[model samples]
Target: MASLSHLNQQLLSTNTLPFTPLNSTPSISPPTIGFRSKSFGRPIVASADVSRRVVYVHAVTSDDEWGPDRDVPYAGVAVAVEEKPVETETDKLKKALVDSFYGTDRGLKASSETRAEIVELISQLEAKNPTPAPTDALTLLNGKWILVYTSFAGLFPLLSSGTLPLVKVEEISQTIDSEAFTVQNSVRFAGPLTTTSISTNAKFEVRSPKRVQIKFDEGIIGTPQLTDSLEIPENVEFLGQRIDLTPFKGILTSVQNTASSVVRTISNQPPLKFPISNNKAQSWLLTTYLDEELRISRGDGGGVFVLIKEGSSLLTNQRN
Candidate 1:
C-alpha cells in the first residue's frame, strides 16, 4: 500500500499528459500462448505499470501513413492510471481569497444617488454635512473627551444593513491639543467587511492639535485621555464625505480604493477624533498631490473616482 501511494504521488507530482489506447487490428493474427518476441520497442511507453502481463506480437511498426518522421505515431495499448496533484500555500491562499469575496454575500455597491442619499441620511442622523472643513484639528474640539477604540463591531452591521453607504476611510491616530495634528498609522479600506472581518490591531500615535505628545492607553477611557490645545476646525471631511469627529479611539479604515498608497506609521496611535461639537457637520477630506486633474467616479464600484478636478476645486453632481 505504501509503495502504491508513493507511486501515485510521483505521478501526480509530474505534469499532465493525454492517454490514448490502441486496440488490436482485425487482420493481425493473434499470437499463441507460447509464442514470444525477443525484443520490445522502448517498452511501448505504457500509461501505467499495473498488471505486468505477458503478450506476443508478430511485428512492431510505426503507424505512419503520413509525411514527416516527426509526425509519426506509435500505436499500442496497456493500462492507464491518474493521480491527484498536491496543493501549495499560494494556491490555497488564492482559493481562499476568491471564496471570500467573489460571488458572495460579502460584496455589493450602491448607485451614485443612492450613495449620496445614504450619506445625507447618515449626516442627518449625525447632524453633519458632506462638506469638509480645513485640515486644522485644534479649534474644533478643544475640550471634548474623544473616545477611541480598535474595533469595527457596530459599523459593519450598520453598513451591511443598507442603511449606510461605504465611504473609503483612512484612519490615523494623533494627539490633538490646542496646537497641531500629527498623523500616526494610516490604513486604507479596500472592501466591505464580511462578518468575519480581520482585526486592525496596531499601536500608533497622533500629533495633538497643540503639538503635545499624547500616548494612547488601551485599558483607559473617558478620563481626559489626550488634550488638544489648538483651535479645532468647525468641520472635517473624512473619506471624501462627512462623518462624526468624536473623541473615541477605535479601528480607522475606509472601504474606498483598497490600493491607495497610504502606508501604516506611528507605533503608538489610537483611532479617535474630537470635534468641538457633534452638532456641526463633519466630513472626510482626502488629500492628494496629483498635478493633473483627479477624477472621481460615481458609486459604481471600488476605485471609481467620479469627482472631477477643475483647477484647485473638485466638482461632483449631487445625483446621477
Candidate 2:
C-alpha cells in the first residue's frame, strides 16, 4: 500500500494526466460521480430483467473501409493481389494501451509511468474519436461491453483490496439492451469458495448527441457460482520479481477438494436485490468515442472508461 501510494504521488508530481479530463471540451461537463464499484451494494428488481430478455449475439464486420486487407488475385493484376498491412495511428495506440495494462491489474497495479502512458494514449484516442456524438449511433451500443481501461478511482480500491482479503475481481462489464432502452453494469468477484457479482440496472435517457442520463433503478447481489476448477497461474511478478506458485500448489489443491458441498448450497439460492437511491445513483455519461467494437466515455466529473464490445478483435488481439 505504501509503495502504491508513493508511486501515485510521484506520478502526480510529474504528470497531470488522469486527474484532468482527457481532451475535455467546453460543451461537456465533468461528471459529479464516478463509475460504481464496491459501493453499489444490495439488489432490487431490475428494470429490464436481462435474465429473461434475450441479448442476441451476432458476428460483426469491420466498420472501417479497409476490411482487413485481404488479397484477391486476377491473373493480370499480380501486384495488386499482394496482401497489405495497413495500420492506423489509432491501431497502434490501441495496442499500446492494451500492452500497458499487461500487469496493471486494471489500473490497480499500474505504475506511475504506466499510468501516464495510459492517460496520454486515452487523450490521443479521444481526439480522433470517429463518432464524437455517440448517442447518434445507437445500434452500436446494443451488446455487452468489457471494460479494459478506466481512470475512475472508485474501482481502483475495489480492484486492489477486493471484497475480501483473498477475493479478486474477475471482470467488470456493462450490458446495454438498446431495444429495451436499458443498461446494466456488473462487477464479478472471485473467491476460494465461489464466484459472485454485484450489479446495477438502469434506464437511460438520451439527452444529447453525445450524452446520456442514466437513472439507476435497481441493484443486485448476484448468486454465487461454484468454480469449475482451481486454476492458478504458473507464477506472478511481485515488486519487480517473479515468484513461482509451484510451492503453493498443494495448498490450493487441498482447498479445491473441499469446495463441493458448501459451494453447491450457495449456488442454488437466488440473487438478492434492492432499489437504487435515485439521487446518488444517477449520473451523466458523455461518449467521446464510439465504433463497432470500441467505446470511450467520460463521466460528469471526467472519469474515463474505455470498453470493448464482447466479440471485438480488440479483446482477441495479441499484446506485448
Candidate 3:
C-alpha cells in the first residue's frame, strides 16, 4: 500500500444526471492511482478526476485523503456567484457616442480626429438599430429632441462667433407632433436679459420606410422674452473667447426696472410668422438610428445629425 489516502465519493448508478457544473472553469489535479498487492497479482485500479462544463464537483481531491479500496465520494457544492447586470451592445455604443460629445461644443469644436471617431461610432450604432422604419414609428418620435451633435456645416454660423458674443446659443431642438404630422425646428438665443427664438414650422410626409419629405411652410422670429433677471456677469465666454461685460453690469442694473417693463411689453405681442417661399426650405431626412433616448439621422446634404431625447441622462450629464 503506497500510503493509503482518504477519498470521498458516492456510488452512483450511471442513470441519473451527474451534476450541474459550476458557472466557471476550474483547475483540477491528476487522478490518484492505487497498486494492488503484488502477491495477489491483481491489476492496479486508478480513479480519475471528473469535470463538467461550468461546474466543479468535489471528487476526492481535498487535503483529507481516503483509502484507494473505498468507492469515490461525490458531493455538489453551492457556489454563491455574484451576477452582474448586463448592458446590451446598443447601450454600450450609445454610451460611447454620448461620451464622445463631452467637450466638442456640439461638434463645433471637434477636430478631424474627433470627427472621424464620432462618425465611426455613429456607423456602429446605426448598424445595431433596433427600430426599423423610424418614420412609421410615430409614437416613438412624438416628443421634442435636443440637438447634441451634428456634422452639418450649415448650422456652423449659429454656433460660432457669428451670433456675436453678447448673445449665446441657448438651444437647438426639433419638436414633432405625430398626430398632426407636423414638425417644428427651433433655435433659441439668449441675451443679457431677454431670450429670443427663430423657428420653422414644417409639414412632413413619409415618402419611404426611412425617409421623410419636409416642406417648411412658415418661419417665426419669436419676440424676445424677458426671462432672466438683470444680472451682469464678471465675464462671458463664447467659442473659447471671454470678454469683460462687468462695465455694463452696473449701468444695466441701475436701469433694469425700466428695461424689464419694456421687454415684457414687447414680449407680450405674438411672434412674427412669415410664409417660406424659398425653394431651399424643403429637405428630406433619413433616420439611421433611434432608441428611446437617442437618435441619429442623415440629411439630404450628406451631413449626420445626432439628437438626444429631451430629459435623458445624456443631457443631464452634459449639464452637470
Best by lDDT: 3
lDDT (Cα, tens digit) per residue for candidate 3, span 236-298: 898899988877876778688788778768977999999999888899989988888998999
Give a tens-digit lDDT track for model 1, residues 1-320: 23323433433344143221233222323321222122333213233222323331222232222111233243433233344467754334323322323222222334345444433332232222111221233344222121111112333453344334543322212222334332222223322331111222222233321122323222221111111122234457888987564432222223222212222222134534442333222222222111122211112122211222222222121111
TM-score computed on alpha carbons, candidate 2? 0.63
lDDT of 3 at 281: 85
lDDT of model 3, residue 269: 96
State in Å the error of residue 286, model 3: 0.2
Estimate, for each residue in 82-155, the C-alpha lDDT of model 2 and write its tens digit. Answer: 23467989888877777777776667667789889888888898898888777877888889999887778977
What's the lDDT of the predicted structure labeled candidate 2? 0.69
Order the candidate numbers by TM-score, best to worst.
Answer: 3, 2, 1
User: What C-alpha lDDT values do all the predictions have?
Assistant: 0.27, 0.69, 0.73
lDDT for predicted candidate 3 compared with the true structure: 0.73
Among the numbered candidates, top TM-score falls to: 3
Deviation from native of the Cα of residue 248 in model 3, angstroms: 9.7
Question: In candidate 3, residue 108 scores what lDDT?
Answer: 88
Q: Which scores better on lDDT, 1 or 2?
A: 2
Candidate 1: where are CA atoms >4 Å away? 1-90, 103-155, 158-320
